[model samples]
Target: MILAADLADDRGWKGPNSATPEVVELSELLNRAKIYPLHDRPENFRSPSSVSRKIGNLIGSHPSAPRNALRTSAGEVPIVNRFVDDRTPMKRQAADIRVRIRRGLL
Candidate 1:
């Protein structure tokens, strides 16, 4: 559960560019917003499932998601080799993707 504010302040992390319009809008909204971790908040800070459900409501699946989806061709592979300066192998990328999916992060 990475916080957006932390990513915004980390100097060593070269995160996604904020020059895009969507990032600019999000930055404007997050200005001066302080997010305390659950342990530091009030007694009724809420459980993780409640937070997850709220987030799912905000940006989760759409009613017509399946209908509007883009289908890839049989040979199409979506993985890109940009994690390191040197190219990472497709097999490693596939394995990493499987791990992430297993951990419910995908």
Candidate 2:
């Protein structure tokens, strides 16, 4: 969610297209973090499509989201709000997560 929010803030909303570079990057990051195991069902994997959907959800839940944003789940609102209200910490955590993933510590 933090990464997606950062992407949206940096690049603006790109919609939920798996082929988009933003979604693909996020998917790659998630996969590198081992968010989904190869032995798991294909549908359970954090593929580009899944990342796009999650991005959509996070964008939609943001208070300043676009008019055409997707309908967000209630459970996601607080997270989105926190990301918006405390971006510096959220970004720091995201960076930490990325470092851990790269170092095989996640």
Candidate 3:
């Protein structure tokens, strides 16, 4: 989620239907890491479209979000707010997650 937020922050928000290459890459990373909310459903992992929607959610929750920003779930607001307040920690955490994924530890 943090990574998606960072991508949205850096490259501007792309609507859910048109995922950027970065979003697609993030989706791949997420699938490779096997970090699904439902652990039992390995087949139902993150797809590019899902990652794009998550990015949209993060953008929608941001203070500077555009008028047409997608509606985010209540649970996402706090996390989005934390990313808005201090992206450094989130970026560091994202880097850590990438490293762990690469090391096959995630």
Candidate 1: pairs in clash: none
**Per-residue lDDT over 68-97 for candidate 1, one digit per residue giving the tens place of the 0 to 100 score:** 333322221111112223233533554564
Best-to-worst lDDT order: 3, 2, 1
Best by TM-score: 3
Question: For residues 35-91, could you state the per-residue lDDT of candidate 2 as single tens digits?
Answer: 656577475477888877887887888787776778788777877777778878877
Q: State how far residue 51 of model 3 sits from its true place (Å).
A: 0.6
Give the poorly placed runs of model 3, Cα more than 4 Å off. Answer: 12-19, 36-39, 42-44, 66-68
Candidate 3 local Cα displacement, residue 85, angstroms: 1.0
Candidate 3 structure lDDT: 0.75
lDDT string for model 3 (1-93, tens) is 777777776765445443568778887888777454456655646788888888888878887777677888887777778777887898788
For model 2, what is the error of residue 24's alpha carbon versus the real structure, in angstroms, after optimal superposition? Answer: 0.9
TM-score of each: 0.21, 0.79, 0.80
Q: lDDT scores for all predictions?
A: 0.32, 0.74, 0.75
Q: Give each model's clash number.
A: 0, 0, 0
lDDT of 2 at 12: 57
**Is candidate 1 or 2 superior in lDDT?**
2
Q: Stretches of candidate 2 above 4 Å error?
A: 13-16, 41-44, 66-68
